[model samples]
Target: MSPRPSDRRSFLKTSVATAAAVSVPYIFTSQDARADEQKSSESNDRPLVGCIGTGSRWNAVGPNAMQLGDVVAVCDVDANHANGAKKKVTDIQSKKGVQRDVDVYEDYQKILDRNDIEIVTIVTTDHWHSKIAIEAMKAGKDVYCEKPLTLTIDEGKKICQVAKETGRVFQVGTQQRSEMGLKFLQAIALIQAGRIGDVQHVAVAIGGSPTSNSIPVVDVPSGLNWEKWLGQAPLVDYRWAKEGKQTKTRCHYEFRWWYEYSGGKLTDWGAHHVDIAQWGIGQNGDGQGASSIEPIYAKHPVEFKDGMPLQDDRYNCATNFHVKATFDNGVVMDIKDSHQDELGFNNGIMFTGTKGRFLVNRGKIVGAPIDELKDNPLPENAIAEVYGGKDPARSNAHMANFFECVKTRKLPISDVFTHHRALTTCHLSNIAIRLNRSLKWDPKSEQILGDDQANAMQSREARKGYEVTV
Candidate 1:
């Protein structure tokens, strides 16, 4: 039955109200109404979005952003990336007959300063994630940041706190949480329904961190601001080349392999795999992370501190290491390599429960025991319920989720507090590798129990002028 406009509005109001009463910590607040009204009053008549970091992911995100509202501005440290995105947005808008034009910027803060921009899509390298996101939220713009939510544990917590204080809608880019075929819904339902009979262990396999390879320092390409590209990270010689003489910019994807810019594969792939592990284990927001963690022997030989790599060149993160994280519920999450012949890439996770084990990744979900459960029948709208019944195919749905919360003041599904707990697990793995020893952790306090060195690793010194304040 088609509902009346007033009826639909009433339903939305009631849904939002009911959502608020559910005691979800991530709920949006009243400020969203003010923002909405302000947006309506502005003659722009479009939800202006700024893209920060226009590399690979932005290609997917830019078109989606345009469909959602308007890509008014695009920011990238590299001129090529910035101009590329701007041209793409222009082409899409032109083809669609949407007369909107987008401006390009090297500094994201300039985009933040504009009142017209209501949302910022952050697809920068891992290191810049928290710094720019926190600042954008503080600037009164809703943030849609890529995962792993933060580069460090402390950064994750700070982001959570700032979102709470500012009442801005923040969505972490963990699309698996929204992907229907992943059987994320099935897994969550089974776990929540006790179908797995109390999950005792979760096994996640992610790729190893990049190895340190010497690249000669190169000259900084023309039309690119090399210093600004470094952002908050330490200034390093372009490794393979010197400044000014460089033929190409050190801006974009290659930065992932360097410690100064990224956490290598640990933060790269671990962000996705570990996030699933955390979700399946039901550790989100104010929940304890892995109670204790230890590193498993690396199949490939690598230098170690405690169990972490000691070298700072090429790759500073571990290439091969298994971290055992024990949850408070006696659940052990083993983040390790998949048995080569048996599991191949081991790019997914295996959840072991009293009933049996189930494996899931982007493309597949398999289990001998749960095989019967698959055809047994899934509840109607089971997948939709996981996404709060939103369209899963929508690329900007996560951003839409944030915007909806901005107006309704409801917590996003991927709120900061919840993501913080998940990030704790990621950080623990890094710490275990760095320390090269098993360590006790207090998940409740989010600290390394009685270990000064481990505790110190929680936060790092932010580069000058780029420090984040909670």
Candidate 2:
């Protein structure tokens, strides 16, 4: 028998209240909880999964759903996106002779209310990551959130805390961690094995930051809940122009170039590259952050004062910028864009060591001065040992890892604590470029030491009613 409407509401309220009582933690477990998870997977008829932020990445997640579990719900601010994912899941289920139906919703909260969902895949923008992941965890659902982890440094810390408290499996969507033969894995292994001969400096080059451009307001499309889409952000009219209606303004994917919505290319790509830098440098936890950040050069599309906009113009971020970060361990990480020649590799992480230097991006890895390392090879089991030696071809491995941990009440590999440290580097770069000055950072306190202006950039005031709380 179907549950009465009142009964369903009562159940949802109780579940949310119970989830809120859990407290997040600072540490996480690295072991796989497959033994416990296997029992649950076998006992249950099938796990019902939900997806939030159904964007382009949905294409990749579709096949994984068929093999892993049932996609019971899909939610997106855009109706088109929500419907698109719903169709995909239904079509796949139909082919398999599964009589299950996938529901669609414009608001993600609707999905959270359904007790049938065991997991949620989050592919929202950077800003929405923490909010949705935290709420989902509280609702007792395991989370598979896309990379760069948190939108802000504070959000990163909060996510870690929430995951620990809820005992929900949370995995950051940095798929390169699951990719085999990548330079990032190889570089870290070499450094750990002392093949790098006391690593001192590393160079990481990502793309540009946002600009100070104010686009004219446009009509919000039918089916798009613009207000809900702007959750946690100030309510503003949709400034994006329709297709073929080109203006001097940018929106959507171009939203990455705005301070309110994103941290430009630094966060967009840095989430991947800078993450690799953090792993190699061994700075993946609390009290483990960069000590200093300096913006050597920046060419902004508009003027600014210590990261604040001076003019309400078209763009608000830097068009070109170079930043240098010094860790307490005396390691210097230089992040810049190489205009000299494109570097052949536009976006990736590069590590330079005393022994040699290696560059790693998606599906590609190359090295220089390889003769010495080629002769003196790394340990046969180094890479596997670092990443727990898991198979790369396992579909949705990162998400699967999170689910395994959820059943055992263990933390996934890309837990919030480690991810926060990585995001700190990315955020600092954006802040430095905006301020266009050198700033001292106190990694121990997670604040900008001695500089009030720099410290203020750590977090922003959430729009009145959209504030996120513990």
Candidate 3:
């Protein structure tokens, strides 16, 4: 199950070899930031802020952003969501029993146009993230965007380029890197410390998406702007139907179950667990990631023709999948939709290596290797090193780290660069499954090797009006 008794030299070789090679470069400089906004944000304890896409996730991200900064505006295509967010932010910021009115907008541009706003929290649907985030950075606003950060591999590239170009302190809301009681960080620390000893394989179990019945076409809700909500993707009729009392729609929280909008659980939970897996193995770097992605198995709820789903009325994303991502360094990562409960993992990551193996999730970190930590404790700085050389305790809350970085101008805990590399692997997995084949990848150039058809899936053209602007 594990490696032979190895000498100190070989153990050090396995652990320290990759340590210096993959240190994260977390800081970048921003250009053309307005003097007044910068002065107001940096000099003041709380920054002036805005919130976009205040549907389900905003109940969490909105308050987190508002707690760190004063929310002056909120925007959403849905009037109900926008008005709801207005009350949420005002209630959080208002003193004592008194509350204030927050500005609400159907168009996100108004918030971006404000010279007074210093930061914006983007919790929009997957397709809207890149466009609004890029434009916000150009307008001199720092951003805290939710995860599954890109709709396609090309979107990830554009986001990284603009983040570097604008020098914005952009943070992707992958809280596992900061929160979850630091179990993920501990797992990474153990891997980097040779406790797992040159990890040969990583198994990530994020459960599958659920299949849905054909949701009948219905009139778009009165307050919701159906056209704007479908920005970037091809416009489709509003679909909503009740199944035994539960509402299934083509938008909002259920959007992840549709390939046109998101990548199902591969990106949903993969954004958290896979991000950590790559971070542990030191693959969360430029030009040093998965060399190939192969789909072992995949099953979707609807039929497919040339990778596009045939039915528009049902959830179309893959319901079950087993994808393998191979690294040039001989580490193979297997990402599956789910795992057996009797196998000791339902939703978590299991890292197996030559020396030992351990399992980790939000709840706990356990295995024979973890038990060995008692007599042979890890180096004191192990977790700190995995956490970009900062005290791990400092970033206990993800939003706290984001706001702290907003003032210090340091990189947020979950910066855009590493996230892009991790997300690229997830995107490649979905592409391989959709095409029902394996893929050769060139990490340095960020391309699909030897496959023209597969390469085209890396980017998608937006509808005429919603294209991302440089």
Candidate 4:
């Protein structure tokens, strides 16, 4: 059993040694040497992995995890996904000359019960992320969970507490810190290097969510356990309908638009963009965040009451929003769907500071400040310093970092502590938009000040069977 919350809190405040991390050599940087490195460092002379929530994202992260460790099991509520993942894992191992049959199951607990499984990757839908992750850590397994790691603000806090108590190496799959051509990493380094004078305001144009009209309730798909798939969310009829010869769904990939399962673009994209914004502004740390969040404009396809959508059949999350969040250090972050009309990248972050400014996305980094870097170079170790003293230009990047940290017992680049803080701003933005109001936030306390109803929105009551027990 995990330790009591009080004991955990006491331990954390006094002797939690996250900063006392063990430095690991970049032995897993190349594919040819990764297996040899794993054999040398992992227990029992092999790294064993189990995967939960093998859905759309599993294709990307799951295979990468398999590269560092031998996959032993795969699980999902949908049998099709689980079986598909099993075959994929089996095929990948077959090529590596380590032929083995991978166990497939619908219950995630089965994967946690195995004593040999040292690592687990969670690529589930947004709502189920925190619970499975907490349980895995309690089971003494290291975790690599996908982004938008929590459905609610309080859930993120609970995950962080459990992680510290378990002493597990948990990596949040916000790969922007590690991947996307190293642009985001460089952006952070530039801001810290004072290439841009004091950051005055940052705008994240992550694009608006797609709005869908009333989707007709349809029969649950075959080979799917809808009840278990719903997990902590309230039971609702399976909804699907045709759109331009394509079937749009409330299940699987399209769950992002629903408020019940996900936080739409606010989190779907905010998890990547807002996280960078907070990091660039030095707010993605302990007890640091925006002092106030004002919902400048919010447009929804359906009306909401008490943060719940009045129209049950249509997508309800905010479609277009322009929220202004102010930090205690006198920086402002505007989360919006679009940038300047002339600058139509539609998806990028623009930083404005006293000295200069720049905009960076996955494709490119542009502006005068970036151009000046041709001659006005930063320190050699600038990017590595931002990345916690490791080389970010590795072959497998994020997954490789997780594998390395699993051996060292150190926190990875995107640990839960910083992610929860950055994600709090996203969650708060959703709350302000849902209520159509502004909020004063106490970052130190992690509370929405002066609004009891908004404070209560920080957590949701889990369904009886799906409570996220630590």
C-alpha TM-scores of all predictions: 0.84, 0.84, 0.89, 0.90
User: lDDT per model, in order?
Assistant: 0.70, 0.69, 0.83, 0.85
TM-score-best of 2 and 3 = 3
Return model 3's CA RMSD, one decimal.
14.2
lDDT of 4 by residue, 1-470 (tens): 12245534543443223212212110112333335434544544458888998998999988898778888778887778888998899889889887555777677888798776789999999999999999999999999999899989999999989998999999999999999999999999999999989999998988887877678755556667766777788756666898887667778888998888889999999999999999999998899999999999999999888877877677788878999999999999989988765666689899899998999999999999899989988899999999899998977799999999998998899999989988999999999999989999998899998999999999988877899887
Quote model 4's TM-score: 0.90
Model 1 C-alpha lDDT versus the unseen true structure? 0.70
Candidate 4 accuracy as lDDT: 0.85
Candidate 1, residues 1-470, lDDT tens digits: the string is 12345534543443443334322221112345436535553865557788898989888767766776777778876677788888898899778776555677777877898787788999887888988998999999988888777777889878878888898888888767766464665677666666677788888887775443434434444444555666676554333332354322234666765545666566777777777778777776475677888887543234664434444334455567777888887888877755363655558878889978788888777786457766765566665676666655555566667667766778877777777787778777777776777788887777788888888888878768888786
- Candidate 4 deviant stretches above 4 angstroms: 1-44, 341-344
Q: In angstroms, how far off is 269's CA in candidate 3?
A: 0.8
Q: Deviation in angstroms for 411 in model 1?
A: 2.0
Scored against the true structure, residue 254 in model 4 reaches a CA lDDT of 87
lDDT for residue 197 in candidate 2, whole number 0-100? 72
As a whole number from 0 to 100, the lDDT of residue 154 in candidate 1 is: 87
Winning candidate number (lDDT): 4
